[model samples]
Target: MQYQLRVSGNLYKELQQHLFPGDGKEAVAVALCGRYERDGISILLVHELMLIPHKECYRAEDVVCWKTETILPFLEKASKKDMAILKIHSHPGGFPAFSDVDDESDKDLFSSVFGWCESDSVHGSAVMLPEGRIFGRVITPKLESFPFDKVSVAGDEIKVWEHNTSSYSPDDFAVRTAQAFGEGTYSKLRRLKVGVVGCSGTGSPTIEQLKRLGIGELVLIDPDEVEHKNLNRILNTTREDANLRRLKTEVLSSHIRETGLGTKVVAYPFNLYDSPEALQELITCDIIFGCVDSVDGRHLISQLTNFYLIPYFDQGVKLDADGKGGIDKVSGTVHFIQPGSSSLLSRGQYTRQILFDECLRRQDPVEYSKRLKAGYVHNADVDRPAVISINMQISSMAINEFLNRLHSFKNEPARNYAQVSMDYSDGSICNVAEDDLPVDDYQVMWAGRGDLSTFLRMIELSAVKV
Candidate 1:
């Protein structure tokens, strides 16, 4: 099985500060992680970090040794919760590979950790360089060490360090793309597994752009089937598909495969709310695009991203027209969400009442309709006008936002443009900085609580088994 370690941007900054305190000697820290294992992929999501003080360890430029008792408390805690442990240390000299000394130390440490935890689960150790690039190995129950497939830091800028580098030569189709965004950026795209949670409107165009840009893998999630009304917006859909009631994910997956691009696609013909299997696959993605219009769907995705330490790009389009053929408003928004930061809720995208109503409508539509008729719930079932041009525009903007996060070609830092708003009616565009957004206290409390018994820590999901 392949192994990966995921760390939130904020936590990585903390680790960096303690690991490299301007000292020539090595420093060490320990992380208690939540585990996710499925489909031959195992991931460790760091939940807590414990940095050993310099005074507690014997330090040298090449090696550092600390008392095993220093981590006893963490070991006990992890054992109680059946969590995994990862020990990380700094390599101040920029050593590219783990030394023999590190191997022996890991062996001794993980051996004790396994025995104390009294489980066959895996534990790991890693080394971080001065430049913030990390590489690590996983230690098995048998005390055998295997290099980790990759170590990813999910922050304002997504960073991934792979143990083995696969050589990729851009084909003629991608030559223009490589020239526009350096070959390095193109290569990064080929290694990313991106998830698009909707399959129509914005989601269709977003998936098309990602595939053309040579995204390595695409995970498509949507429960709806092709319908006559959506034919105008969903890309590559035909009348025959609507007649056959083909699933949106199936249609998109087929279209991507027909392009002859090397990108792999996995389609889930189910919604994220009720399908534990869909959630299992979604959590494996490196990045997620929220193309759904429902407030509850967006809220759930935001929560999932924070828990799994994945970067999220959420897009929405709004068009209001008077019955008398006058246009009232035309606007759209694209929000760049980093793990452990302000979310769509804190940005006023939706309030608690709206989320509750959406949930009620989804779970008990008959009751919701009755409540609406009784004047207890707002009427949210109106069908809004959807234009292909508007959907494409917003989709392109969201795709560009993802590219900016990867290559950072923008004039200002990405943190300055947390949200981009466009108003076609007023012919105006605006950007909001992360500092301007209110802090999401709820997101902060739930971040990195990965792979819980109940999905996303919701009571409704406890009954669904993957």
Candidate 2:
């Protein structure tokens, strides 16, 4: 794949910081996000990625960029068929020429790019000059730099260089991201199966976003419907959608398929603790997200994820409404539950009491049946009607958790707290994985038939000397 990257406004500032030495980076750099939008697409870069042993510097020096250390690990994680198109850099001076040192570096750099990034494909690199001039170069398998001086960057994507001689131009950022991802990260996820538990509130948006991210198979769990109250949070559902008695999973499945997302949605109306059925879906998903209402559900899902070796991202929101119901205090939490690496639970986020209580409540028939009748067992989870903004926030927050656990693009974004809150009314952000954990003896009692001696005696008595 020929790689191109579009420049976003946010990205422009980041590159300048790394090259020009702003307050941004005292250290390393990184490529944070790869996304698409109507304006164009590009990768989001931030100053946080710099975790190398070398001292970070803004001026030209003997020390290599910390961002450079990040590449090998990324490539090592990728397969041979995938390659990076270019190492986007900046020259604050607006100097068009590659410094003599840059020329020497290009040969060595492109050699590595060909051995890795350009394997069975073509790739390029680019520089953004401080004066706003941009340059790109094509690389051969042998590490020769064919400076495409004729190239131009029109936003995030690059218009093809028309000159036989080196030239330059600005290209579209979105187009470049698409091409880069096609040859690299996105293609690797083509066969993945993702599971979303609870398709209301955050879950609804999460399902939509996952499908958009190109997951091939999704197991959507929920059993609720469209209620006038829920209109506040669920995505795609309108007032017109309310009268139809829409099932959350079924509706979300329809939305995903109708959009040509190419993702297969398996609608599970059953609750997450429903044993055999829940286990089946858990075994099938590559990743799982918890967007359910109950603490019991999270613990159940967390346990399943560990046993199955599937990564799980769980998110929740707590609000303290004021008397007017207009505004008050709110808290949102996102956690990455890895199979074994001292999870959020280890940090005191959730405890055994919360998990067991939830389990008992769900296991009880009266409560389960009641939620079922109210459609709580089925559709979205909210004490009251929900709104769109909160739902999307939860979904995005969950997705963000997923990325933080999976990618090391930047030093983790700062947390206002491990908890997120807009509580002038009062709020806190917390990283509570260390609170309390479940010592689940999910083990079944071995109540096998008592010793057979008594049965033999009874049999003999009944035999009547036979």
Candidate 3:
């Protein structure tokens, strides 16, 4: 089994500050993390750090030795919450591997943490190099250790470090993709698992692009059935499919399988919020594409990205008319939200009232009806203008942004932009830049909050039992 650890940029920075105090001596830090299991792999998500006051520890530039008594309190807290504990320390000497000293100390240390705390939760030890890179392993209750194959950090950008020391060569399909981006990038793309929320206008096109680009696995979620009107925008849909009212996810999934490609596809033919199994399955994806238009769905996706520490790409196209058959507003936007960064709410794409109204409708339809009738809140438009050309343009831009993030072909410096919007009417494009770093305590409620009680307050139906 492969073990991977993901930490938010905010939590990651805190770890650095706590463990790498500028005294050029090693410092010790303790953190509590959530554990998730998928496909025989166990993932640890480091949420927050509980720094130990180490004013009287035996310290050196390469090592720090603390009494086992100092960590018992922290271990007891983790034991009560059933959360895993990580013992993190810094090596300012830029040593990548665990030293002989580490090997001797960890076995005795973690064995004590598990036995003394009386918690079955898995615990591990980590070492941070001078460059802020991390490597760690998971120690079982029986004192067996498994080295992590990868460590990923998600923030304004996505960074990954693989620990496997093996030779890799691209195959023919990947070699062709390497022509544009190097072979290393193509290899990464083949290992990624991408999720698409909506399988309509923007979603269908994005799914087609991802499969053709050779993503390793895809999780497609959509509940709607193909209608005659949907034939205009949805790809891989025939008149027969619309006539038969076939599920949108099934049709697109079938099309991908017919190609005889090696891409793995899992389709969920139900609303994600109503399908707890599908929502939980999203934890396996590396990145997600939000093609949904519902305010409730977008809000869920936003929270899911942060909870799972995955990157999110959200795209939307809109066309408004002046009621005289003339276009008044022709615009679209593509937003890339990194975990623990600015969200759609913080970026002003959505308002608190919208989210509140959506929640009310989902939780209490009777109250929502009364409020709507009293003119307190308005419903979103049911039928909006959609064109295939505009949808394709927006989807293409989103795909290119994903590629740029992976390969960084753009020459400009990287900044965290809340959104990139294009107004076709005025032939203008603008980028709304968000600050470089998140506020110290921003979204603390959701950061590394692996699994919540009701799946971000959607209700009992949204809870993930699996």
Candidate 4:
């Protein structure tokens, strides 16, 4: 089910300045075991694993840990016994070398892995990165890493290989899972084609996380190039990129490649708003992520999500300049749009007035820019989006929404749309949600029929049918 997208076009250097943030690289296996039947749970992708290397003891900042109790929520709804075949997380900090703590952990963790792989013979191996430059391998039993030549991730796909078959170790599973990066977050990701509509701000983080999460194929779109003005945010882009005017999509595609993560990224240096192929290509993806600044973009994407039943996650952020200059307020929203769930447009989250106006102005970037500099009654302008904190907050919220949509969590959580505003005008060490704000057209979707939650419903319905 793994997929790949051949990259095309040259990326302008301006766009390269937006990937990776603050002191961090990756150091763990982003592995996935798929299409297996034993778990009875149709398909599952376990992420953010903490591997016990029998020689290391450590904690993780980026490990995607599943609340062991999270499994309980699924039991009442699904039929499969719990199964864990995949183990992946990065050496977020410290050397990629397994700590003594890792040793204590890997046995039981892999014990789970060993059991999960019962249907298969070879256990999965450990993927470790000693440094940003070298990707090391640690096979179970033998515990030695062969060197991989080059790691590439186009979008969601992850491929790890040494010289050839010689690097394929029978003792570990990373060899095979690494082959496809089988939807690193869900068993279905391998078969799913994803689209990233923008490559700056939230879009950059979205793609960065998607690469780490390991999806098989991705199509990237964005006509904008990196600008020094964007240095305040945008993941993975470097400052130097601004000087060179690199295309956002191309630069992001290269950064994804650097991870040695195997994903196929198809780059299109065009705005989805004007690109006919954009909608056509997105229609084919399992899910679509929207990160463009135009309300028109989100409205258009929402319409598409409603028609095709493709799951979509959209993020919006706003920040008010500080009275004296230090950003005073931040706000963000993360909304999940299920194709058949609800009419995002009908809800009035996006108005025909705004959509039409933006559409009309789409042909003229400069005129539209002037109007945005003038601001609107309820519109977010790309020129002055909510500062980084708000952007980061909603980015995390959106990523979590992706996770929630992927896994079958308990409670059949309702309300897939939420927006929060932050104002530290008073300056207190606390977090609060901004309510009663105008959400006149905030569309709500994902009425539980797009992903694992959808599957969870099926399981429950089937149980009732019995």
Highest TM-score model number? 1
Sorted by TM-score (best first), the order is: 1, 3, 4, 2
Ten contiguous residues minimizing lDDT sum, candidate 4: 6-15
Per-model lDDT: 0.90, 0.50, 0.80, 0.48
Off by over 4 Å in 4: 1-185, 364-382, 410-466
Q: Write the per-residue lDDT of candidate 1 for residues 1-466, one digit (tens) a residue.
A: 9999999887898999999999789999999887887889888888888999999999999999999898888999889887889999999999989999998999899889998998687988999999999999889999998888988988777888787778577899999888988898888899999999999999999999999999999999999999999999999999999999999999999999999899999999888887888888889999999999899899989988998888999999999988877768999999998877799999999898989898999999999999988988877777889999999999999998889888889999888878999999999989999889987987777677677777677887886452
Badly placed stretches (over 4 Å) of model 2 are 1-182, 343-345, 365-385, 412-466
Model 1, global lDDT: 0.90
Cα RMSD, model 3: 3.0
Per-residue C-alpha lDDT of model 4 across residues 394-439, encoded as one tens digit per residue = 6776765565545434243323232322334554322221122232
Best by lDDT: 1
Instruction: Count backbone overlaps in model 2.
Output: 59
**lDDT, residue 378, model 4:** 29
- After the best TM-score superposition of candidate 2, give how far the Cα of residue 133 lies from its true spot, in angstroms: 39
TM value for model 4? 0.49
Q: Is candidate 1 or candidate 4 better by TM-score?
A: 1
lDDT of 2 at 287: 72
